[model samples]
Target: MPKQLFHHFNKYLELTEEHFQEILPFFEIRILKKKEVLMEAGNMCTHNHFVLEGCLHMFFLNDKGTERTVQFAIENWWITDDLAYLNQTTTDFSIQAVENTRLLTITHDKQGQLLKEFPQLEKYFRTIYQISYGAALVKMRYLFGLTKEEIYFHFTEQFPLFAQRVPQYLIASFLGLTPEYVSEIRAKKRS
Candidate 1:
């Protein structure tokens, strides 16, 4: 693992060398095959994952059994069932590997211990949650108000790599559109 990944943590809080060493020991590296489920609805989320490579998606199945993607996390991103993780209850969402993925996982118990042992880690996580919350709020607003074409363009502009890696159907679900609508939008954009 490139120590550079730690820079994401450093952005929010200053970690002393000793603190970093203490925190590092608590994280375990995990690899997942594509389509593997990390956390499923009705199961407690045991760990929070920081992606080192590939993509993961958080989604819930509708009453009709269709998957509605709520969020996608690519390399250098974090993914977890935030509500379940914090409440220590069953998750409503499912988190799955969209591609073969490398992740650094920190268990809830270990994370709590890390907070007590290294206050800097607490500060880092607080900042991360704040950003995640804000982004989710914006995405919800856009999904309610924007057209499929607008959503596609916005996502492509902000996360071109994700647009390239994720399948169009998944992107359509994220945008609250059908696959045909997504295909139509892409065709229009190309012309």
Candidate 2:
């Protein structure tokens, strides 16, 4: 678990063995069953989870009570409500395991201490957050502006494994399309 975490961090910033060892204690490994909710709406998101295996989905209900998926985290990715975690405030989002999962989670206080102990990690996390934010911006534009077919194709092109790993309804929700519409599109493509 620590090895996987080390590999993830090393991609963004180089860390000395001593520094890595020092920060290792701050992370706690968690195993979650499929459909298990890690964080719920109206609760503070106290920890950021690093996926070692399986998938996680972050979503919230819209006014019509439909699930609107904001993000998905697979292996080697991080998942959390950034604003809630940072501000220690309640979140409108819920995070859950899409499959049985292995995670390394860091609490807000531990994250601060770990960063203080190894400043290089700050660069790694900042880069990760920037990328996440940029992706969110692009996704927002696509959701509102793109045609449903185009959005589906673009999503599959970018994250091909998502169609296999996630339920069709959830994928449809994320693309702002109805599940029946997604099925129709798939049928049309097959024909």
* Residues 88-148 of candidate 2: C-alpha lDDT, one tens digit per residue: 9999999989999999999999999988878888899999999999998999898788898
Question: Residue 162 lDDT in model 1?
Answer: 82
Candidate 2 CA-lDDT value: 0.91
Index of the highest-lDDT prediction: 2
Q: So what's the TM-score on candidate 2?
A: 0.96
lDDT of 1 by residue, 1-191 (tens): 73545777777777666656666888999999999988889898878999988899999999999999999998778899887898788898998899998999988899888788777677778888899999989998887887767888898889888888999889888878889988887788789
Instruction: State how far residue 127 of model 1 sits from its true place (Å).
Output: 0.6
- TM-score for all models, in order of appearance: 0.93, 0.96
- Worst ten-residue run, lDDT, model 2? 15-24
Q: What residue pairs are clashing in model 2?
A: none
Which residue runs of candidate 1 sit more than 4 Å off their true CA positions?
2-4
Q: Record all residue pairs in model 1 with backbone atoms less than 3 Å apart, i.e. clashing.
A: none
In terms of lDDT, model 1 sits at 0.85
